[model samples]
Structures are given as structure tokens and as C-alpha cells.
Target: MFPITADWMSFVIVALATLFLIGELLVSTKGIFSILGLGFITIYFASFLDPGMFFVMIIIYFFGLILMIIDGKILNDGTLAVIGLVCMFVSVGFTAPNMVAGLYAVIGVFIGGISSFAFLKVFKKRQMWTKITLFDQLTEEAGYSSINQSYKELVGKRGITTTDMRPIGTVMIGDEEYSAITQGKWVAKDTEVEVMDVDGTKILVKDSEKLQKKSAD
Candidate 1:
């Protein structure tokens, strides 16, 4: 099993190495997965390359792993993650002695990457990923309600526009200022307007004078 030589063995070795390596990042395994991954990858590369070449390939593989971590923790985007997979595949492929073995190794990297997610279900996930990706629903019990909830209470309140309302401007209601929109009508600054409705955070308003004239009709 050490220093795998058969074409099919390339697939098995590469897959196991990738699975354990990525699993190490997804959940806490106390370094067992890391040791296993390093052992298998070292064996696969040592099987066909000189010592110098082996070191170069190993460095390339780990560089790919670093890119994946940076993408997840900082970018919160998948771009670097995809590039990392390509890097791992290339390292394994280039180390293989033949085209068939290279092809097998590349496929193994893809399969192992997808299977690593299974660790998330079986073990407690690493806490580092939670800060950027997971979020709790905001509720009153959490010491606060959603921001939109407070905006809902402002409906029917009268205020004066602090800026010209070319359908969108700022208004002062009592002592507080709010961004508001009119019904596609332009109103000069200092004109009185009433909050006609509130949809989520959006405040819809109409000129108070126009509203009273319509009520009189």
C-alpha cells in the first residue's frame, strides 16, 4: 500500500489523502486525519518521483489547501476554493508516472472534496466557519426585534421633508430623521408630508396638503 504503483491504486491513494486532509479542516480530529493524509500523499508522490520533485509536489498540494482556507474564512466566496481544487488536482496529476494514473488521481481529488462535507454531519464542525456563515434569527428574546418591525410603527405619522422630495428624500418626524419616498411627485424642502405606509424599511409618504385636499373632495 505504501508507495502505490498500480493505476487503480493511484485513485484510492489520492482520494484517501484528500478526504482526510480536508476533513481535518472541517471538524476536530485531534491531528489523526492530518497524519493519515500526510502519510498517504507522501507515499503517492514518493512512488514515482525523486526526493526533490516529491518536495515540490507536496508544497503545491499544501498551497492549494491554504487557498481554500483563505476563501472560506475571509472572502466568504467560492472563487479561491475552486482554484484550490485545481491546484490539488494538478499536483497529483503531475506526479503520476503515466497518463492513466494521472487521470485517476485527478478524479480522486474531486470525489474526496465532495465527500469531505459528510464530516460536517458526523462531527462537530470547526467553530471558525460559523462566524462568517452561520447566523441566528433576530428575535425579541435575543434582546432585539428586527429593524423592520420598528419602522412599521411610523405609518400615518406626519413630518416635514428636510430635502426636496423628487420621490426620495429625508424627512424629520418629531426629533428623528428618516429616509422616505413620495408617490412619484416632487415636493419642495420643508413641505409637510405624512407617512402613508411602511413596507419593511421603506417609508412611503405623500404631501399632507394634497392628502387633505383629496379628503375634502
Candidate 2:
């Protein structure tokens, strides 16, 4: 024990640890926040529990934190996050010296986790979280966007079906081939087709012969 007489100190220590740890994972803090968080958590656990229990509790807490990070960065769902928070709560609450300290520690975990978001406003976020959360969007200005400008230019142009469009197949437009759909029509291979629309990467085409026949009718 670290000779801490105050029960509220548990809350303070745990809260600061969680805040910094979560902030470090969510944003780019250059490891400063991680160090501070680890330091506080170590002190908090060491001050109340035996050496063996201390290590166990620390492992549980970190396991929970890892789960939350994984959920936020990859799953983008609350299921794993909820389980992770529960694990953290168990570790801190079980290691406290008394019921009051346990409750305080639990509340601290929740508050600290929630407060970690404040750091996002103060620092540049990690690229992984930003992408998963859609905080950043891919656009033409990004220099390597997936948006293909060539497909957009193909609208209203004439082409020939290189493969049978059992509504979907390839079309040859001026020696360049593109994947195209025939608006639910089954046009045969080698049929003349005209580019009707372009939605993102999807190219919609219609049979040029049918279009001419309809026009003549």
C-alpha cells in the first residue's frame, strides 16, 4: 500500500489514468498521454492491492482498454466497447479497499473514458480512428481518391457490348472497355449500346438499336 488515507484519491487516480489512456488511443499524443495514464494507473493499483493482485487488476484494466480501442477503430459498434467498459469496471472496483472506494473507482472509469474525447479537439486524431469514424472523407482533393473521372465522361457516348449483358457485362467504347449494366435488359454480345448514365463506378447502358427503333416508331 502507498499509504493513501483518502478514499476519493482512488477516483481521482483512476479517472486521470483512464482519461489519458483513452485519449492516447483515440488521438495522436506522441506517447505523452500514454505514459501519464500508465503512471497514474500503476499508482492507483499499487496503492491499494498486493503485488500479485496489482498485476492482475492492471492486466484486466488494460484488456478492457484494448477492446474499446479495437471496437472504436475497426468494429464501429458498441458491443465490444460495452464489454470492455465492463472489464475495466470490474478490475478497478474489485481492487478497491472498500465499497465506497470501489464505487468511486467505477464512476471514475466512466467519467474518464467519456472525458477522453476532449483531447480529440486539442490534438490531431489517429488516422485509423478518423477513417473508421468518418471524421475524414475521401475526395478528389485528397490526391488519390477512388473516384474515377473517366466513367463520368462516358455518359451519352456510344459503345458495343463486348460480352452478353444478361444486364451486366463489359462494353467497348472507342477501344476502351468498361463494366456496364443494361438497365435490366438482356442485350446480346456485340450489340450496339449507348451509355445512359453513370453513378459513381456503375455505368448504365441501353441498346442503341432499340433506342433508334423506338425513336423511329
Cα TM-score per model: 0.87, 0.83
- Clashing pairs for model 2 are none
- Candidate 1 least-lDDT 10 residues: 131-140
Residue 153 CA displacement from its true place in model 2, Å = 0.6
Candidate 2, superposed: residue stretches over 4 Å from native: 1-7, 27-31, 124-135, 140-146
Write the residue-wise lDDT of candidate 2 on 1-217 in tens digits.
3555788988998999999999998889789999999999999998888899999999999999999988977897889999999999999999888999999999999999999999878899788665567654587776655646888889899998889999899999998999999779899999999998888899999999989999999
Enumerate residue pairs that collide in model 1.
none
lDDT of 1 by residue, 1-217 (tens): 3657589999999998999999999898888989998998989998988999999999999899889878977886899998887888899999999999999999988888779889989988877777776556667788765558768889889999999999899999989999999889998999999999987688999999999999999
Q: Of the candidates shown, which would achieve the greatest lDDT relative to the real structure?
A: 2
